[model samples]
Target: MKIYIVGSVGSGKTTLARKVSAKLQVPHFETDNFVWTRHLKGDIRNEIEVRDQLLQDAIILDHWVIEGVHKDWTDPGLQVADQIIFLDFPSQKRVQRIVKRYIYQLLRIEKANYKPTFSMFLRMFKWNKYFEEQMKPEFIMKCNVYDHKLYRFQTDKEVKDWFHQIQRG
Candidate 1:
C-alpha cells in the first residue's frame, strides 16, 4: 500500500500524509527530509545517491507513504507507489491556509524547511502563476505520463472520508 501524496504549498500534504500513514500503520516519508541539508541555510540536496537510497528502502517495505510538492525528488517515489493523492483546493483557500499556518509556526517558533518568508508569500500570491509556472503543467504532466491512480480531494471532510474508505476497504 504505497502512497504518494502531492499537493501545492500549504495544501496540507504533510498533515494528510501523517494522518493516513498512522491510520494505515505504514511508514511516512516527507520529501523535505529527503532533500534538506542538515544546516539551516545550506542548499537542497537532490543527489541521485541520496534520493535513490530512500527509494530503494521504500520499495522494499510493504507499506509506505511519501508526501511532498517536489517533482524532481518525488519522481522516483511515484514509480513505486500504488496510490497517488493530489490535493487541489481553491487558490484562495490555499492562500488562507498558508498564511494561517505561517503565522502559527512563527508564533510557536516551529521551523519549516520551506519557511513562509515574505518573499515566498509574495510569489505564492499569484495562485495561477504557481500552478501555471511550477506545479500543474510540469509535475502533474509527469504523474499523468506514469498513469498513476490519483485520488483528488478538494475539502478536508472529503479527504477524511477517503481515508476512512481506504481504511475500511
Candidate 2:
C-alpha cells in the first residue's frame, strides 16, 4: 500500500501517516527529509534534482506512507498512491497545533525533523495563512482529479474513526 498524506502545516499529516504506517507495518517517509538537507550552518533545501530523486525513491517503495504539505513536488507520489489522505482541519485548529508543536520543539521535548527556529515558526504561520487563502483551492481542485483515491478528514474525531475503520479492515 502506497499512501500519501497531504495538508497544511500542523494539519496532522505526519501524525496520521506515522499511525497508519505503524498500523500497516509499512515504511514511512517525510517530505522534509527530501526537501531539506542538514548543514553546519542550518537546514537548506536540496537542489531540485536531488529532491526529485529522493521523492522518486520513496514513491517506488513496495509499501510506504509519505506525508507532506508540498503539492506540486509530490505529484508523482500522488499519482502512484493507493490512498491519498487530505487532512482538512480548520485554520484555527491547525494554528493551535502548530503553536503547540513549535513550543515543544523549542523546548527540546519533541524532536524536530528539521531545524526549529523562530524564523521557521513564523514561516510556518505564513504558510498556514497562504494555504488557507490560496493553496487550499488548488489542493481541492487537484484532489478532484483523484477523487476515487482521496479520503479527507476535517476533525480529529473523524481521523480517529477512519483509523479505526482501517484497523477493522
Candidate 3:
C-alpha cells in the first residue's frame, strides 16, 4: 500500500507516517529529506533536479509511506498514493501543538531532523499559518479528484479510527 500523508508543522505528519510505515512494513520517506541536505550548522536546499528525482524514486516503489507539508512539487506522490491522509486540524490546535513540540525539543525530550532553535520554532508558526491561509485550498482542490483515496481528519481520534479500518476502506 502506498500512502501519502500531508500536513503543516505540528500536525503529526511524521508521527503518523512512522506509525503507518511500521504497521504496513514499508519504507518511509520524508519530503524534508528530499528538499534539504541537513548539516550540523543548518539545512541547504537540494537542487530542483535532485529533489524531484528523490521524490520520484520513492513514489516508484511498490509500497511506501511519504509525509510532508510540500504540495507545490509533490503532486506525483499524490497521484500514486493509494491513500492520502490529510491531517486537517484547526489552526489553533496546530499552533498549540507546535508550541508543545518546541518545548519538548528544547528539553531534548524529542529529537528533530533539524536543530530546534527559537528561529525555527517561530518559522513553524508562520509555516502553519501559510498552510491554512494559502496552501490548504490548493491542496484540497488537488485532492478533490482523489476523493476515493483521500481521508481527512480534524481530530486525533478520527485519524486513529481511519487507520484501524484502513484496509476495510
Q: What TM-score would each prediction reach against the true structure?
A: 0.81, 0.94, 0.95
Tell me how far the alpha carbon of residue 132 in candidate 3 is from the true structure, in angstroms, after superposition.
0.7
Writing each residue's lDDT as its tens digit, candidate 2 over 46-149 gives 99999999999889889999999887988999999998989999999999999999999989998887778889999999999999999999999998989999
- Give the poorly placed runs of model 3, Cα more than 4 Å off: 167-169
Q: Rate the local accuracy (lDDT) of all candidates.
A: 0.77, 0.91, 0.92
Predicted structure 2: lDDT: 0.91
80-126: candidate 3 lDDT, tens digit per residue:
89989999999999999999999999999988999988999999988
Model 1 TM-score (2 dp) = 0.81
Winner by TM-score = 3
User: Judged by lDDT, which candidate is best?
Assistant: 3
Clashing pairs in 3: none
Q: lDDT tens digits, residues 57-94, model 1?
A: 77678899888777775576777788889888777788
Stretch of 10 with least lDDT, candidate 2: 36-45
Q: Once superposed on the true structure, which residue ranges of model 2 sit more than 4 Å away at CA?
A: none
